[model samples]
Target: MTDTIFSARQRLSANMRWMRFIVLALAVFFLYSLAQDGFSGRDNVESMTDHLIVLFFCCLHIVFYIVFDRSKVLEFDAGFLYVKSKNGEEKVALSSIHIIRLSSIRLGYIRLWELVYLDEMNNSKSVSFQPLDRQVFSRFQEMVKIANPVVQINRFRFL
Candidate 1:
């Protein structure tokens, strides 16, 4: 069988959902601050910091959304699965994959679903892949099964 390249769509979807939730919460907080102090005149650094923080979060969410949304496909070639990020590329190898663990806590958290990849021969190359949904996770698992059937998958009750 041919090798499977796993995408990060599931993880991105979960991240996007949480980002939306955070944005909504921030909007409520902004409104609450406006209602309490009025936007007429505020020269306090704390208030400025709050606004800055919210802006910073919004920008970060936007950037993350764009990158994840754009990278719909991941390519697996030879021993590596290529990760295309906004900044550059990251290659993860099958031999480097040490453990695949399913998380129970923070069910919808973006990075909760993790596949820990470790390279004992090269300490600097250890990495992890966090795919958000069952479909993608399963696909990845299947790929790993095909690539290396001996690899262990750790399943635990999520809290």
Candidate 2:
């Protein structure tokens, strides 16, 4: 098997990190401001509504970050696949992959691709990224065919 490194688009990844950080900081600042007000009744309904809206957005960002933005490295080499994430690193054999799903997800204003697959242990794992190399899909199809011909592949776009 050829040694290939498939990484997330660096610019998009960095932007995502920055956005998450800013949202979290804003949430903290909002909380501090609310505390200074002694949690009083909504004397100013408009101001209270605006604060709630910001808090709602901050919560959504945290949920998405935990569920999707985890993968760090995706490397396929020597018939094995290496996935490194914030949680940990897992090495899986290509033959163990049964199904592959490629889909797009829209987060706020940006659209990113998600790669999901089922492993031998029957666990569904996914990585959200935009390929730095355009040949990534072709290389993946070629490798999957050679390693496991019966692997089911599906592609979809969510607009």
Candidate 3:
């Protein structure tokens, strides 16, 4: 059997749970403050509105990360690509992948990179992580080209 050629590990899964907890706690605290203070004056209403906006963005941020957080490890061998996570591991034949999309999103100071592909059964699977190396995508693209010349690799960035 051929040795493992490339491996990409999950970046945010390790600390994402804590992040969610902290953000939720802050949301609860802000809501509590707004309720206790009571909306009476114009200044108070403005302050409460600001808090509400912040809370809205906080919830959206957590949801975005959670939705994209799926795989724990992605490994490539000579003929197959393996995706491992809490549920289990899936082995995908190289030729079975038709489209590979790589996208990066920036939120404030944090940036996340995601890899999405269609499986053999035409199911879309995504793995979100910040690659340790900037060249990881290039290297991965090169490997995919060797395995399946027809594979479509798309890369884009978002804010």
lDDT by residue (tens digit), candidate 2, 44-111: 87867777776676676577555444535666654766666667767777777666655556656554
In model 1, residue pairs whose N, Cα or C atoms come closer than 3 Å (at least 3 residues apart or on different chains), thus clashing, are 11-132, 104-158
Candidate 1 lDDT over 40-153, as tens digits, reads 577798877876766666566565555444432344544556555555666667666666666553524444444566544565432333454666557667677777777778
RMSD of each: 7.3, 5.1, 5.1
Candidate 3 lDDT over 45-139, as tens digits, reads 67767767766866775665464443265665556666666688877776666666545566465556555666767897776654445565466
Which candidate number would show the highest TM-score if scored against the true structure? 2
Provide the overall lDDT of each model, using Cα atoms, as 2-decimal numbers.
0.54, 0.59, 0.59
lDDT of candidate 1 at residue 108, scale 0 to 100: 49
Q: After aligning candidate 3 to the native by TM-score, how far in Å is the CA of 155 from where it should be? A: 4.0
TM-score of 1: 0.48
TM-score of 2: 0.64
lDDT, candidate 2, at 129: 57
| Model 1: per-residue Cα lDDT at residue 96 | 66
Q: Per-residue lDDT for 103 in model 2?
A: 54
